[model samples]
Target chain A: MGLAKRIIPCLDVDDGRVVKGVKFVNIRDAGNPIEIAQRYDEQGADELTFLDITASSDKRETMIHVVEEVAGKVFIPLTVGGGIRKVADIRKMLNAGADKVAINTAAVANPEFVKEAAEKFGSQCIVVAIDAKRVNAPSKALRWEIFTHGGRKETGIDAVQWAAKMVNYGAGELLVTSMDRDGTKSGFDNELNRSISDLVTVPVIASGGVGNLEHLVDGIKEGHCDAVLAASIFHFGEFTVGQAKKHMAARGIEMRID
Target chain B: MNTIAVIDYGMGNLHSVAKAIEHAPGNCKVIVTHAKNEILAADRVVLPGVGAMRDCIGEIKRLELDYIIQEVSKSKPFLGVCVGMQALMEYSAENNGVDCLNILPGHVELFDANMTNAQNERLKIPHMGWNKVTQNSSHPLWQGIPQDSRFYFVHSYYVRTNDNNHEAASTDYGVKFTSAVAHENIFAVQFHPEKSQHLGLKLYDNFIHWDGNR
Candidate 1:
């Protein structure tokens, strides 16, 4: 395949503290976003995505400064999301040194905004972020629905189908996260990931449910995702990019390992 | 003192390119600036980028680096990485239309969509991660680099050589494309040396000690 399984470590910042527990619970402070990102880069992370979990206009200042600092320290690509509601916000993030902008609530509130941002900045600059949880049965009617507003609100759109449409609206990449599996450390939702990946032409990043290196491998092999994004596993010293890549290489997956 | 002026016109990965160079080999001062004089005085100038060829080449025109670079391209060692390398060509990769550096006698076009896994379900686009490199002929830049060694690559558009003489190295995917090329005083690699590790370090070391005059 043209795609290599990506090992991405996401940073969720709340009032400048990196917190992680179980399923987004027991939320203990992890570390500073900047320090965590720097260490991940050293540990050989393919790319980094930062989400300001407590994103608000007030929190924008802290997020921007953190982005600027991390962008300076890390050389690889960086994607910043959350609190990006206005066109000006996207511009500010780009100017502040973010390579790509991932949007969730704002995009669902106004899908037109994704087109506008993509048109202005180029498709490669916009990432349509989807946080979806499986319905009780995930029947034909409930398959792959979109979850937004920090995974509290549900927009009756099918996550897989929505991903397929987001590309037409001009999103460069797709960040599909599973709310149920997030921080579970149990594993990733390969079936859900595969269903959506099959429906989209754009690169689909598998998020949530990464407990160890094997989960990452399953995310790539079973999910058919271009990249596997995790936060708790990489943040809490579960597995490093190097160690994961070693496992991936053992499985005949090509990775940049020194 | 060898100072490498990293051209900054809001059109490329200027900082990372400079960072990689700084982290590479030999003592050199790396500064990202639009200052033409800094470029004029520096021992070497790097025109590096990771954006569209259109945006990058446009900034070069706006900042008037085209003139300074033209002069430096003739005498000193000039290196292009990715879009920087594509710019060395006659014209390639204009998202809106055709606007290019026209340095080398070649063109860069989008990867044949057939090559993308989305299309053929075969080779990937934005060819991410490490892949192997195979050298066709000997060049100093390839010195110390091993055979069948892998390097990091992340791009869809590649420089298609119209003149074979400019071709230096090649990498394989489903099909082989130009990975490294050199013509006269210019040298560039599609695979990122900065991202590439010890082997990449050897690449930087070779470039630093290289005397392209031969």
Candidate 2:
């Protein structure tokens, strides 16, 4: 209730470094995760989250070092995700200093994982990350389906309804990444964003397809969600969080300017 | 020569914050530290973070950085960025319920799932990307930073401070949570000034030159 719309910059990590993939292909290294996170932190980023892309590889312990290194240098709330398939994994992440644990495929595979994590860590520490894609024809009943395995497989789960279930299972927040809008910058899938945000009780973070500032405003005011997440635009330094907030203010969207 | 020593907990990205501060006209010297002496003598203080609030808070306690922060912020220009900003809260409900510096009043809890509404669906977790910052009051940090100037955000939980007067900025994530706050000589933002490009650096510049009048 303090402000409207949040802007976030993401760093997709592979092998303890920052890397970006074009449609999850042709991967390119950005820099050391710690260094890159420092750069984003100084640019007036509200918070920092790390997605250990390699977490699925089962080298989970290594991500802790990454988190430790980055957390030591920067002074922001940091969340870590990827390969978080178990409550014990969540405990390890927390012990490693992660503020929140984001789980996707694992939560879907064992729905009880959501409830268990929530019961153990509190709903505030459990974040349900859903990777969703919009099919060609949008059916009113269930047009969006949950995609897992780095968004390669569809779970046939309704993005809207599944989000509600996560909350029921004691999810503190939802990080929704639009597979279609991801990295495209065509703008966020506002239709999907608004719908999910309107449906969920917990705060919803709209992800993917943020080419510019207007998209962020649309995601917050139009989408009526709690936060907006992006990468390329910020990673490339195309625009700063400050500029985007100014634009949002112009649109009458509440934001933290200074 | 009041220096603003940034707390280096062995996890965050500090170089960028330092570089951004140096980029600005803020005369205050910005230096990353795990030492106490540097913190005690500084005219201003800054804490920028990435990674876990639990770890940062732990390191601060482990290294006895909290006392230094409290001591400095009591009379000097104190600032916290990102997780650093959240550390200023009373406690973090994330990661084994970490106890924070408690410098700023209020606790930061995760977005309650039970709080979600049932009518909508679309947005998702991690709350990453760029978002607007709503200014609720006038402060030195806002001198040049335009209203709605976006700041990069990447956290799911936000600070829920109770003091309305301390709040300087707010961002929506399900519900509005305190984003930027000012208490006497202390000023903290949930956004990163270094990574925020020009507008964010401008705030840092303002923080450097803040006379504490506005």
Candidate 3:
């Protein structure tokens, strides 16, 4: 049996509540993290990722509690990100029922932390999240640059080079978000995804810019992503995880149907 | 009431494993504990592991869990998951090669850097996500789980048994390797049943009902 392409639904949790703003009914009801997670799980989502967008000191405890509460009910793998800086932060998340922890700003701040975290908690549980934006300037040879602090800052590090470095640092997986295409819903930045996917040997999860099932199909087929992570599309009831799987299946893509 | 003790060596996600067992259809009481007495008293034992082999063995040896696992595995129905299954082997090439429990006749090998699947596609390392497991033996764990049922796996290394008789299942990832191993009272899998949806849950259910004799 071949490895099935993963379709992940991402939830942006701000201050213990799921962030709203995506055009959909009961967006208020979707605020309940547990309910949203349960719905996705029931719909047969391959996995779930919760990014704590709050990234505040006070909200850390709340986020941990949210992870614990959601993890208690959801049987699938849960990946928690945002505000994770040190190994201690990763430990707290794991102890709180997170199967894997995604590090972003911290990895950019201290490149060695990736290796340290991978060493302490096995590379399998450490996922390096890279927020990349395409460089429009013609002078730059690299197509993308790594951004941090929720895409508010750029590190000037070549995106492809950084991807290779993280793998060298023992990162087992990569969650790459294309800021250029994120929230746009036009489609996944296939060029950026393909570049990073080609540079790294680990599984690359294509995040951002998914408006429909076709976008997801593009992410896996053209971009060569191991998985696809979308927010608004799944969060606003644009498409169910089952519907996405059906589309991928019809396209001759291997997926876990059950 | 029968108790299923999930061994916690401070390495992997013990709660998730315990939660799955708690949800399994049975009258069994699922306990997540590192206590020697509790583990020894349980009707069945589950060794759930993740993380590097060195740290896993470090904690296992430090807590004297290695002795307990070896002791309980012989008498009761024992199940191992991921690194837990790998730890039972003689040695692992991970972390520049480390010695394992040697309970099973095999050694863990890392997926080759240049590994390619039958389709000649360059396979990704760690081999994450769901893949079908082809059962090779008539073990009780395969009772309800369909043939070639998908199971969730996340590992860069795979096991190579010295004897094919102990190999319960095999899966393809660039190369077909042993995915599940069964020898006498023990049944172990490389996949995380806790994360593998309904099909995975069925394996756990079968484990709870399985007699140690098989």
Candidate 4:
């Protein structure tokens, strides 16, 4: 068998609790991060991503604690994203038992941070999260631009060029999130995913806008992503990770199915 | 209680490795250290490396862990992981070709940039994700582990031994590459057993009870 396509269930963690919102709005509490993480692991999630959406710095310690507890019990690869601004932040997360750290706004603010973090910690642990919004309509030439501050501020950077630049700056993986389709329960922007995936040599994780098992399949088959990350679909118990894997495997996608 | 010294040269997921060992079924004191004395005193030793081969080897030499690792590998139940596995080879094509510990007879090479699968699709580098590893030969470490089990892997470079007898397991990632290697008391793998979930913990448990024999 070859390298199986990964199915990652993302948990939007806020103050140590798991939360999910529609297009980054109307937040709702899911459950405890540790319990949710264990449940996902039991369901055969290939990997788990924890996006720390906690706004207050004082509450950030909760995220670290959550990572530590889950990491102690969960055996799969764990990735921590959000609020990672400095190398110290990356260190704390890694030391807290996170296998990888994803950087978004910080990388946009200072591209050098990616290089420095990758150098300090191996590139294998550094992931560049890109939040992209479509600049052109469905009929026009495909174009997407990077947005920061939870997709409110525009960086005026092309998503495709930014992805390649991050890889050059030593990003081991790219987490591409579609702003337009995120939480809409529609699907992933396959064009945007393919655009960034084809340009970079590192693995690209397609995130945001996963509504069904078919979307997971499209992320790999059409979007060309190495892995698919969904927050609501798996978090809300709409579909189990095992079901997603079986569906993807049946659709001719090589998945890690026991 | 046995002590498994996870040799720390300032690289790799030392926390995860130590934690996994502690969580394994076997009762052992897992310490993440670079002190030669502690490593020598331990019943088992683990060499874990991440990042570029040059950096991994550089830190091993800078910290003077090379001799310690060599000494422990001779008699102790030694396990190397990822770049740790590559570092056991004589040479590596990574970081402009660097010398390794040469504990095992092999050369580490990068997966071709243009490497494609049977479907003619180009595979990503690093080969990041869960891939099934086919056990090539029977060994103590393979005790509870199934014949073909999936393990978590995240690396661009792979090991190729000069002697086929050193290969313990293989995985197909476009090209069939050696995923695990065993030479006497030493066993090394390109995949991360600590991050590989239940099956991975089983491997660590097996390593703990291994007697460093055939």
Candidate 5:
């Protein structure tokens, strides 16, 4: 069988609780991180990503505790992100039972940190998360620009170029989230996903704007993303992971049926 | 007490591998260790590696786990997972060609970019997620695991054995490639059983009960 496309459920955790919002605003508590993670795992999620949206230094220990609890119960790959600054941060999360750690602001603050972390703790465990917004510039050819601080500020780095550079810096995977479509649930930005996915040899996980199973399919079929990550759809029970898998399989996409 | 020592060369997620073994339906003590004595003394040994082959080989040599692995593989039931499986091969094309343990007669190669499926769609690198693995030959590890069962894989490079006889199972990623191999006391897989859910745990259960004779 060919490689299967993955459906990942993301938990936008804040202050030790899973939260969901509209465009990263108007936050509302969803449930306990551990309970939500266990539910997703039982629902046949291919992978789980927990992003501590708050990223406050004081809440770091709580995040680690959440990771340990979720990992102890869920027997799948768990990716922990948000406020991951240094190699020690990555080490702490991994030791807390996280399979991989995703970094955004820290990597932009110091690109060498990405290279160092990859060298210290294998590129396979290092994921570079990029939050991009479509720039409506008439002069420049670059369509999307990278954003940091939970997609609040723009970094002026071209999204496609930054993705390739991260691969060169030893990023095993790229989690590209479209800020413009995140929380809106219109659909994945297929054009942006295709551009980034085509430039890098590594796997690109298309994140954000997954309104339904069709959006998830587009992420793979058109966007060329290896996997699709969604927060609201799976979080709010708008769609089940099984439904997504069944739809993809019906469309001739190879998925684990058993 | 049946003990399984998971070799830790300061690479990959050894804790997850240890926990998966502990959770597997058996009363076994799973230890993540780098000590040679503990590994040699354990009833079973698991070598789990991740990331680049160059760093993996370097750590294996520096920590002298290479010798320990060779010794342990000869006597006890030895299991290799992911890059641990890749390390058993003679060499890998990763990092511009890095030599491996040479425990098995094979070499690791990168996924060809131009490779496509019957639909002419190019497959992504680091073949991630669940895909069915065709059982090439029946072995003890396949005791409960069904034929053509799905397993979780995450890697850019895959094993290409010189001898097809060692292939226990295969998977199609653009082209058919070896996914699992067995040679006497040694059993290795390019996929991660720990991340694979129930069927993966079944593989671990079978491994724990295996006698290493086949």
Candidate 6:
């Protein structure tokens, strides 16, 4: 009886609809947020994260409604990320029933925003999302730089140092995504995850690449993440959240298997 | 009809908590309110909170909820969650030591910064995510919920009752801490039952029908 490493299924929502193809044979509606959320909840997903990728501000209200609908049915922690820019944005999502909101570019634009959000809304409900890619440094030492705008724009900030700074700024949790391995079906950047996980006292959620259940296990075992967040594998019906938990538990990783 | 009043002192989000209670297999109405009369009139009261202990206590006092909470807890079935559980303690080490409601005889302490598990790996603060909670004593809230059920937890500090008899459950996270407490009509937990899925909803259902008796 101990703390179980979590397996979070992330749904990338674009204008209120789930962006990925959730090819679950049983699920009739693929893009419906509530159905997808309920499916994950039934599969024993420890938590659900909805990353709002909608580009237009006018359609952002759709994400809020999606959250409201999902939170009503799915009885688990829900985290909404992607476009959180200010304190009001955080409040709106929380009011919409999101357990936490992930702040990315805004924290980079003004690091004080993270501090202010944490102060106003409490650190427990604030998550800092970091998109990092490996950088070619002069020395042989491993170095990764922070990227914003969905890993498109580079900030030139050191990822590890920025992680520690965010924790100092009162971020309750850090969602570290590896840009290099993301979308590659490769495993997470264990080295990148371990560096930040070891440096910060807060829980580090390993995100990005996760092709199979083994990648999820590696996230906890090798990456030293407190939780593993994956998008494609779970959304594509390649593996269920229950299957991943069972596999992780079989691999000697503590999992909350129902 | 039984009503569950979720004391909302302008802290963290209470929607999920209220929604969870309403979703439970009960016909009760759950209202999130800071109004003392509404809370006192309800048969069950739930104190749901998050964030720092200082702010929780500060807001409770500023709203003059201290008296209301003390008054209702003595006679009604009350449940405290996360920082709400910590707030019932005498004091807390968070925010450089802040005093609490003292409704429960205990103190809240931060997880040791240098603490490690048996693997010698450093344990993270804010011990986030799901953890198995071992029921120390049987209570109405534990009804139907199996022992050692995993529940969602997200907090940096933990509570320790001055008396062990007050403890209802314990969870291991590098240390065996008091995860839940039961005393008379009051039951509190360090974990977020609202986010614990089915087992969590079961606990809420049990609380709804619990009649403040052993």
lDDT of 3 at B3: 91
lDDT of 1 by residue, A28-109 (tens): 8889898898888888787889988874567668888888787666766788998889899987887676778998899899
CAPRI verdict (incorrect, acceptable, medium, high) for model 2: incorrect
Task: Give the alpha-carbon lDDT of every model.
Answer: 0.77, 0.75, 0.89, 0.92, 0.89, 0.90
Colliding pairs, model 4 = none
CAPRI band for model 6: high
Scoring only chain A, what TM-score does candidate 6 earn? 0.95
TM-score of chain B of 5: 0.98
Measured against the true structure, the TM-scores of the candidates, in listed sequence, are 0.87, 0.59, 0.96, 0.98, 0.96, 0.97
Question: Which candidate achieves the best TM-score against the true structure?
Answer: 4
Could you tell me the fnat of model 1?
A: 0.05
How would the candidate models be sorted by DockQ, starting from the highest? 6, 4, 3, 5, 1, 2
Alpha-carbon shift of residue B198 in model 4 (angstroms): 0.8
lDDT of 2 at A195: 79
Candidate 6 wrong stretches, greater than 4 Å: A21-30, A137-139
Q: Which of the two, 1 or 4, has more lDDT?
A: 4
- Poorest 10 consecutive residues of model 6 chain A by lDDT? A21-30
Leading candidate by DockQ: 6
Q: lDDT per residue, candidate 3, A132-224, as tens digits?
A: 988858875548899998888988988888999999998989999988777777898888889989878999999888888899999988998
- Model 4 alpha-carbon drift over 4 Å, by segment: A137-139
- Which of candidates 2 and 6 reaches a greater DockQ? 6
Among the numbered candidates, top lDDT falls to 4
Tens digit of per-residue lDDT, candidate 5, span A46-150: 999999887568977899999988777778899999999988899999988898999999999999999999888877788999999999678767499999998
Order by lDDT, highest first: 4, 6, 3, 5, 1, 2
